[model samples]
Target: GYNSHSVLSILMQTYMDSSTVLAPVPSFWGLVNSAWNLCAIGKRQSPIDIETTHMIFDPHLTPLRLNTGGRKMYGTMYNTGKHVSLRPDKTHLVNISGGPLGYSYRLEEVRLHFGSEDALGSEHLLNGQGFPGEVRCKT
Candidate 1:
């Protein structure tokens, strides 16, 4: 059985392959495939429009704690075509908790995205601006 991540990866790959021939626009992503319906209709998608005026700070939020067993961790890095990914070894358990999170989470993967120019790269926008690159962590 395939996990949700695997299924999503397959769907994304299929979309990428088909888009080369179809040239479907971003708005038509969901229309091109049922599995990617969220790409068109999802409210909390990537490249989010972050407005600084709407920002609110929570003073009660605690700092995040990373438990690395007080030792070094080893991981393998891979170029997934879309981005660079790092998957840590299972022997070294890295767990994170606190920081507004209700439960502790393990670091599953780390993804890095960058572009040739500074205008386009980040996954999300900051006050309607784009950064040169971004690092995403999957937990």
Candidate 2:
């Protein structure tokens, strides 16, 4: 188990290193254009604009359940230039269910994004207003 952990750590670090070196540098406008194009082209893109007026509130929606309480969650932290992220152990996957979700979901990782200013750095917007930071949990 120790050997596997060590191997995973090393492999992840290597992958990160290679990815950072190989990733292309894009300007703000270029990034925006690419995202817009992807949103227009892709059928299943995320981070879509959520219009509060069209949002339907269901009283019967159950609260989401996370199975991380009362147990230790082992993970490793890494920096990905723009944000700090945590890579959780695969063996100890987080179980999530409830809400509008039809089935259980397993949390893979988590990322934190922050900006030096209050007007920038959020990955998602709330009615077109940006926040200083946000936390994203991947499942």
Candidate 3:
């Protein structure tokens, strides 16, 4: 009915206006990307590197923070761009923190993407390189 289309239009507008609702930002994506790398390297590739492993505690739905190990390694600077991308998160690593750990990255959220034949359609390109997948990492 007309109500269904109207509701869909509102939802679509809201999603377009609110970026976070669609995808998690740098911290979440970055850590996920790193973890994916490890999973792909190892023999398992089983569960596709669980996203909850990197989940960070948040009281107000805050974005998860990541521990960069006090360094700019992993090129964390580009994480934000990936968040806006329409691709599966393939993070490869998630550094744990403790009482005396350096910086940290918290898990934010997990986003799924699909297209014709599940083809990923994303806006951000890495080094002008398009990928079927991407992970947004941040500190």
The prediction achieving the highest lDDT against the true structure is: 1
lDDT of each: 0.61, 0.55, 0.31
lDDT of 2 at 20: 30
Instruction: Write the number of the candidate with greater lDDT, choosing between 1 and 2.
Output: 1
Candidate 1 structure quality by residue, lDDT tens digits, 1-139: 3222211110011122421333444456678667568668888665565565765566989977778899897899999887898888989877666774445667777778766756465666666666666677666
Ranking by lDDT: 1, 2, 3
Candidate 1 regions exceeding 4 Å error are 1-44
Kindly report which residue stretches of model 2 are placed more than 4 angstroms away from their true locations once superposed: 1-44
- Measured with C-alpha atoms, the lDDT of residue 85 in candidate 3 is 25
Q: Which candidate is the best by TM-score?
A: 1
Q: List the residue pairs that clash in candidate 1.
A: none
Error of 2 at 43 (Å): 4.7
The RMSD of every model to the true structure, in order and in angstroms, is 13.7, 14.2, 16.0
- In candidate 2, what residue range of length 10 has the lowest lDDT sum? 7-16
Which of the two candidates, 2 or 3, achieves a greater TM-score against the reference?
2
Worst 10 residues of 3 by lDDT: 7-16
